[model samples]
Structures are given as C-alpha cells and as structure tokens.
Target: MIDFQPISPLQRTWLLELGLERAFLARLPQAQPGGQSAPVAAPAQEAAAAMQTAQPVERHLNDAGSPSPSAPAAATDAMSARDQALAVLRKSGARPVAAAPVEEVVQRPAVLIQPEKAQDMASLLEQVQACQECGLHTGRAQVVFGSELLSEPDWMIIGEAPGTSDDRSAKPFDGKAGLLLQAMLNSAIPNASVYKTHLVKCRPLGNRPPTQEELAACRAFLDAQIRLVQPRRLLAVGHLAAVALSGRDEDLETLRGQALTYTDAQGRSLPLVVTYHPASLLLRPQHKANAWRDLSLLRELQNQP
Candidate 1:
C-alpha cells in the first residue's frame, strides 16, 4: 500500500497552482479480479507523462537583452520552471544587463589543479582529500569530499558546506539533513542515480560561513568533480551552494524555482536549479512548499533526454 502523508494548506495551494493537486489525491490501489492490485491512478501517471514529454520553453532576447516580440508574456505561478526562468530573466533585463557584473565577481583563482594533474575522479579525490587551499582546511577534522561518483549520474546534488555531522563522518550531507535530502530526491525521482557533494569540502570552525576566498580556493575541486561525474542536472541547495555553483550572488528567492544553467571548464552545460537547504526546511517547515515547487522543476528537467 502506498502511504500518503497529509499535506499542509500551503502545500495544497502549491499543488493546485502547479496543477498537481490530483497527483496528491490520486486514488489508492484496489485489488483486481485475479487478486492483483490495480495500477496507480492516472493523476500520478499523467504527472509523470507530463514530466517526460515537457520540452524546455525558450525565449529569444533582442540586442539590448530585452525580450523579443516572439518571447512569451509574463509567466504566472502555474507556468513551467523554464517559462518562469525566462520570465525572471526578462524582468532582470535579461543577460545583457547582468552578464558583466556576474563575470566580474566570478573570477578564477591564480592556481588550480589542471585536468592533466587530476585525470580521473579517483585522482581528483586524492587531491581533494589533501587540499589545503584555505584556512578551513586547518581546523577541519576531515575533508568531506563527497560520496563516490556515479559514472553517469542523473542528478548531482550540491550543498553549501559540511556541518558538524559531515565533519565528523568525513562525508557530505550527513545526519537529519542528509536523510531528508535522500527522502525528497527519492520521492521526486525514484531509483534515479544521484551524486552528492558540497560547495566547500572542509567544514568551518563553529559553523561559521566559509569566506569567499575559501570557496574560490576549492572551486577547482568542485569543477573537476562535475567534469568527471557529468551529471545530467544539478540541484544546488542553500544560498551558498546556489551562489557558488551558479556564479550568481542573487538572493535565494531570485535564484530558486527557476531553470538555470551551470557551465563547467570544458564548456559543458547542464540544467541547474536552486532550492532551500534541507536543514533550513527542517527549521522552517513552511518553506517545503517552495522546495516542492523546485523539485517539480527538477523532475521536469530529469524527464528530458
């Protein structure tokens, strides 16, 4: 039997806005003539079908980065993630306005490990474990690199930085947050292979935020991991991970629930989305509605080839 947890009124509103209310209220399984259970209702099936067939919505911009006449009008809450992203872009004066500032803040470090130096994920792991790029490394109990890389992961989950449990376990996304993350991911994309990592490898002292210099220091390692894993999509949880991965320091509200892109050193691009961290969600249950919307966006991306 499928267990259906009761959802909040806010969550109901979110589902209604996204046309997913039926999916949540999908009929329970019933026994068939041969004692076999009937297939799950079309509500869930249709949702999955929509996810599988939904093409990314695109909008063209003029020379000044303003939306062309061909661009779609303002997207409402009901619009798809891609549509919402395009809408957000349109409102922000699109890329032409924001490009220069973004580029200015996102500069490469003076020195980083070359691809030739860390050829594969294994070699990169060794180098990362020995990383001493920033002061965070000095007070760290262990460098929480990440889980083992999936040769071809469907999703690459990036978190802000290591927490207390992570530092002790020498793993990224540990304890309650990790469990919640896993549950959420599984709910969205069951059996889909995922690789988890953090923006910064080592934990900061007393849980203070890592400095900008520290994030820059370990940028190469993160980039290398992305290159090696080559995941189809990236889900950056929390403001710091979103900032580090997207190369944009916009507010989390401006960043989340939108279809973004992340480009690696090799120029390979992947679909990216930012959402509230699971830890944050734990503290503020109200935000799970927003996170669910982000997950729906992620599910849409995963459906595409």
Candidate 2:
C-alpha cells in the first residue's frame, strides 16, 4: 500500500508544473483529521491509475533523474530521421532556401534582333500578340500593341514597358500619362502623324524595370516596328528608352538635346530625340520647361531638310 503524507506548497507547485496534480489528488486520503486512516491503494494500482489520467512522469524522470529507455529510443529515432533527411539533401545538392528577389543582372546580353519575315505591320502585330519569348508573357493580361499608325509616321514615340493601365487596355500609352503625352504632342507639333509604342509590350509585375533578358527578347519586336513604321523621326521618352535607342549609358540630362540616331536592322537611320517621360513630368512638373525644350529640338529637327 502507498501512503502519501501532506506536501508543502512548493512541492505541490512543482508537481502541478509536471502535470501530476490530478494523479496526486486522486491518491489523497478521504479520511477526516480525527478519524482512522482510510484504505490505501497498492503501489502498482496507484501508478496504473496515474498513467491513465496524468502524464507519464517516469518517462521524463526516474529515481536516478535520467530519461527512461522508451524516451531515449523515441528521441534517437527522431534525430536519425532528421539526419537522414539532411544526408539526402546533401547528396542531391539541394538544401532548404528562401526565395530570392528578381533583379536586373549586370551582364546584359548583346542586343540581337532577327528581322522577321513579316514585312507589314499587321503581320508583325499578330506575331507580337502571340509572342512568348520571355517570362513576362505568362503574367500579362494582354500584349499591348501600338496605337493606330498612318501610312507614313512623322514621329515614333517609344516609351518604357507597359504599365498597369496599358496592360489592361492592351494599348500603349492609354493612361493619364498617355493623355499628357498626346496633349504635349498636340501643343508642340500640331497635326503631326504620330505612332506610339513601348520598348516591351508586356508589363513587368508591379511596374518594376524589365530585366535585361526581357529587353533583349523584345528588342526584335521593337526593331520590327521601327522597320515597318519607317518614321522620319524617333522620340525616346524616358531614361530606359533613351539608353536603349541611343545605345549610350549616360544620364538622361546628358542625353537630352543631343543629336542621336537610331539605325534599324535594314541600315536605315532616323533622327532620335530623348525627352522626359510624361509620367515623370507629372511627378516633377518643374521639368516641364526641359521637356518643352526637348520638344522644340524635335520640332527643329523636323523642320530641317
């Protein structure tokens, strides 16, 4: 028979922490203080009852304060499984890793555009609408083609990749910025036949800059557009467009107002001008004067023979 005497508060607290309070209470005597001792349970019976209702305390600690055999085997099996997983990962050259951010790599591939067999703009548009050369195609709502073109375009305005609004509408320069650009063109060169497009047709997720690979992939389409339009002058409206068309890695301010020429795949040279994009001008209205000056330059170039 097991006889348990009254325990101190601290001892009771320790037992509670070990999840043994219920089992301890069950073993407590029901006898009154002045009455004779109540019947006691056998040691094995008490242990069995405790095991049914309370945690297995002996597995966590024994008389020697060491883990039991069952406990050690369980722990060893868990460690062995973890080690085996790590070994497999090591053999396969793969490990748990976090996702990396998408960024533009420094080494840009050489800009190469294979002249498409499609000579007309309609045939080229069909090809561009179904282009899947880059990853941007997967996430795009639709491929944005340029606005309607005249038989002979006076100015071919090239902007950066499509934005959210442009992507949704499937037309280049269809948003507020587009409106501002149209206004600017009307105010600067009235009745000028203009065709607007972007460097890349598809919008980058979250309007982030297109990667070099994306730029290279879409360069062919842009070259094809230039060939088909045969515009007398080219207008590159943003830093990226300016750099790509001029092939100069200088600042926009440096490239602005400078005489630049864009040569197509067929060895045709057209006057190219760099200017502030309408989107940027919207944010920084102070640069409107600079943009106006750029327009003046474009106008001057147009007036020349």
Candidate 3:
C-alpha cells in the first residue's frame, strides 16, 4: 500500500517552490487491477515533462484564503526528488560534462640541469650553457653556476641572486657588493674560505627582484648545494637567503644577533646565523654596528667545538 500521510505546511511550501505539485500528482503510480506492482515513469522523463509545462504550482487556499496541508505523499516525494535533481544540476552548472568541448593539454619543457657541486664543475657548466628552465635563463648573458672553496671550509655564504657583474663574469658576487661581502667574511672567519652562490643561477631582467615562481624553480639547486657542502654553520645574507634558510619572512632586525636552526634533508638541524646583506650595509652605513653584533655572534658559534 502507498504510504499516504498528511503533508506538513513546510513540505507544501517546498513543493510549490519546485513547480512540481500538479505534475507529480498527475504522474503518481495507481493501483493495478491484479495484486501486482504499478509501473512508474522514469525520473528523467517526469523531470522533462515538468520542464516543458514550466508553469508555477498553484497554491491551495482555505475559505479565509490561508495555505492548507492538502499535498499528497506521492506529490511530496516527487517534489523532493525534483528539488534534489535541480540542486545537482545547479551545482554542476559550472563544470564541463562529456558533451562539453575538450581542449589540448600543453606540457612545459623540463629545465636544464647545472650540477655545480658535482664531481666536475666544468662538465656541469657546459651542460647548462643553453639552459631554458625559466625566462631568466634566456635573458642572461651567462649563467652564474656559483663557486666553492677548494679547501674544507667551516662556513658557507648564501646570497639572493646573481647581480649584473656576477652574471657578466659567470661568477657569484663579483660586483662592489661582492667586495663588501668578502671583507665581512674575512673579518668573521679569516682563514675559512667563503664559498659564494646565488639562490637563482640566472640574472633577472634589469636586476629586478626575483619573483616567487622563479625562486621556487631554483630552490632545489640551493638545497642540493647545502647537502654537498655540509658546512658547520651557514651565513644567510639578505632577505631572500634568510627566508630560504629559515622558511619564514621575519624582519632582519628580529633575525639578526640570533642563531636560528634549519633542518637538512637528512633530518638533521643545521645551525644558521643571520646577518645583514653586504649590499644593505653598503647602503645603510649606520646599521654597520648591528651587522658587527651579528658577525660577533656567528664567530662565537663557529668557535664552539
């Protein structure tokens, strides 16, 4: 037997919203002559018929013209299903189905590899001479693969990117800023060789700031260098280097005079000392005092056996 319960005012209101009450009542399954199940029309066919009528459901009123609970169980169920179908259609309106046109997927080419710290730097440099990993590689006069100390250096210096001079010479930090960096390194670790590198191998256009996309592309190379060198302490000079090492964008002041720790690929925490970029001190001579304090702290950490 069909479950015929009295409809609630809420159900009647909802059925009226779907414009399905009349059509649903018309298509409800009727009892067969024999004691067999009545066949019902497919939901899709009923939905199409309701769409064709497109007329709003008429409201039932009492003698005082107030809404009444007269909608049947079959009507309520059909209305609920129609509402659910409408909701699904509306939600998927923005997505493409099988009927939608397909577009071709264009894959980007892989970047050229330049293994500067591998067994041989010259062979690796030759390989990356025609690199096109990113747009910067195309614009650069020469790729600054970076330099490493021949000796077992206790400290490593990581900089932001190749400046104009570094790009010209195919070396890192060859400009005036590089000179200041060398001086700072000499004072901090006199006997220790200062290996220099740019976070990005290629020079950016007009020495403009490196975009986040470019940094992401070059991060793996920097990480590789850190692993190869295995320095006791790392000196991150400049905002980009500091952020790369610390995984945060804390201010230079908060970063200075404090020893921060970074986890290496082997799950080992490496000691990192933050300091003002040589370029910064050159521009703001007044902050030299703060830089000296940071340098002092780095020396103390290095001396720790």
Candidate 4:
C-alpha cells in the first residue's frame, strides 16, 4: 500500500483548496466533457503510464536507485515496517498532518537542462523544470528545486527522488518521511535550517529507483546545487542518496553510522553521513537508533575546529 506523508492542518486545508488530489482527480473526466477540473493528476498518470509501458526500464533499480539484484530488498515486510517507522516518529515527537483533499499541482511544459554555468538558484530552478537530461522527465509534473537555499547552510539533506505527494506539492521531502525528518531536525538542531532536495527532480512511476542513465544525466544539476549551496555537511538518506552524494557505491547499510566524505567536482571536500531513507525507517524502524547516532556525529563535525 502507498503511504502519503501527513501534512499540517493548515497545509491540508491548502491542499483541499488546490482542487481534489489523487482519489478525486481519478474520477474527473467522467464528470464533464469540457470541464475536467485539474490537469496535474491526469497528465501525470497518462504520461507515467505510457513511459512505464513503452520504455524497457532497468528493472534492477525499480523503486530506488539500484542496479543490484534485489531492488531496495523487496522481500521486506510492508506492514510491520510501517508500524515500526510510525512508532519511531511518535517517540520523536512528530507532528502528524491530518489528511485532506486537494486540487491541481504545479505543472509545466518540458524544458531542457540549462547549460552548465553558475546561475542563481531561482534561475536554475526555472530551467530545471524544463530539463530533459534523461527519460525521468517524461512524466514529470514539476521540478522540486528543493527547499529555499540559505546563504550558507551547514547541512544539506538529500534523498533519492520525489514521491507522489512531493510531485503534487512541488516540494522535496514533503511526505510522512518529511514530517519524521522535521521532528528529528528540530529536536536535534533547533537553530539550523538544512536545505533538502532530491537527486532526481522528477518522480519515477510508482516511486521506483532511478536508473544509472537517469542518475548520470541529473548528476550535473546536483553537482551544481552542491557547489552553489556550499553546504558544510551533507545528510544523505538511502543507498541512492549516499551513492550520488558520496560518489561511493558501498552498500547503504554498510555505510550507515560511518563518517563519509564527498569531494565535489571543484575539489572541495564535504563531510557526509549515510543513513536509512526516512521511508526505509518506516520499513525498518529499528534503524532509527542508528540514524540518531549518525546525527549526533554530524553535530560533532559541525563543532569541530
């Protein structure tokens, strides 16, 4: 079963005003011929379905960035993992967002990835929405340029890619996982505003892992964000996130709780830590303690001379 991140009461109301989300939009066309309320849900489904059927995908990476035989380990149990992840969140003081209906999401015409020059964040975001660097853009609703860039942030959090709700809201890390992250960040580092974004801006149909070609195409864009943001530390969640950010293909579980470093194209060395994806935390919530250890180490690094 697909799990949507709970949103705040206010956000739920806003989503409602936006015009019925997935479930409501699914029944749109049957209502009226000329007046199907929103275009976001329909086009996404159409284009995504077409892509899913038409292209011969590298199934090894289905649902997470993987070329491994087991895609994010499919044999894992869904029911118990979700329950454990929820318990971890509740213990961490997560503020759950109640469910509400919503309308259209941000949608735009396809554009090409801008030439690789140092453009400001706003300019880069506009260009990314149009970027067609890889096939992932085929069914994209919008580019999650990431949360606002701070002048100089200490931590830059990254995940594999946007999920369904993130695609609709045009916000990275904006689901149940996001609420869990917020709870962790707030309690751990109250004064810091960590910039978060995804390795792939577009959502792969059914939230599968991105293919190698997709990762290669988007690498330049992420590299650009890292350089521009110049974050002091990197918080990479999940195997794919760690691989892309660290440029090391170590098993995610193996790399967890270790001090990892990423060297940018410009030769700047940034400290990074790998941990289970927030979604995975929902899957294997016992790993939350391990993630907490990683976070503690990040703080230690931040205070280092």
Highest-scoring model, lDDT: 2
- Using lDDT, rank the candidates from best to worst: 2, 1, 4, 3
lDDT of each: 0.72, 0.75, 0.67, 0.68
Count clashes in each candidate, considering only residues at least 3 apart in sequence or on different chains: 0, 0, 0, 18
Tens digit per residue, CA lDDT, model 4, 1-305: 12323333343333234332435323222223454433222233332332222222233344564345653332122212223334434454553343345567888656556635757776677777667778888877877779977877988999998998899998898999899888887767767768998898899988899988888888778888888888888999889988877777789877878788899887889889888888888888898898888778776777776
| Superior by lDDT: candidate 1 or candidate 4 | 1
Candidate 1, 34: how far from true, in Å? 99
Worst 10 residues of 1 by lDDT: 50-59
Per-model TM-score on C-alpha atoms:
0.61, 0.62, 0.59, 0.62
TM-score of 2: 0.62
The residue-by-residue lDDT of candidate 3 on 93-187, one tens digit each, is 42212223458899866645755444444545554554566688888888887785444467778888888998889888898998987887679
The candidate, 3 or 4, that scores higher on lDDT is: 4
So what's the TM-score on candidate 4? Answer: 0.62
Off by over 4 Å in 2: 1-115
Q: Give candidate 4 misplaced runs (Cα > 4 Å).
A: 1-115
> Which pairs of residues collide in candidate 2?
none
Instruction: Give the C-alpha miss distance for residue 21 in model 2, angstroms.
Output: 55
Give per-residue CA lDDT, model 2, range 1-305, as digits (tens).
Answer: 23434333444444445454355444444445665545443244334333333333445555785555656544333233223333434455554343345698798544323446767877787777667789999989998889887767889999999999999998898899999999999888886889989999999999898888999999988988888888999999999999999999999999998779988877888889999999999999999999999998877887787
Q: Which segments of model 1 are wrong by more than 4 Å?
A: 1-116
Judge candidate 2 at residue 177 and give its lDDT: 94
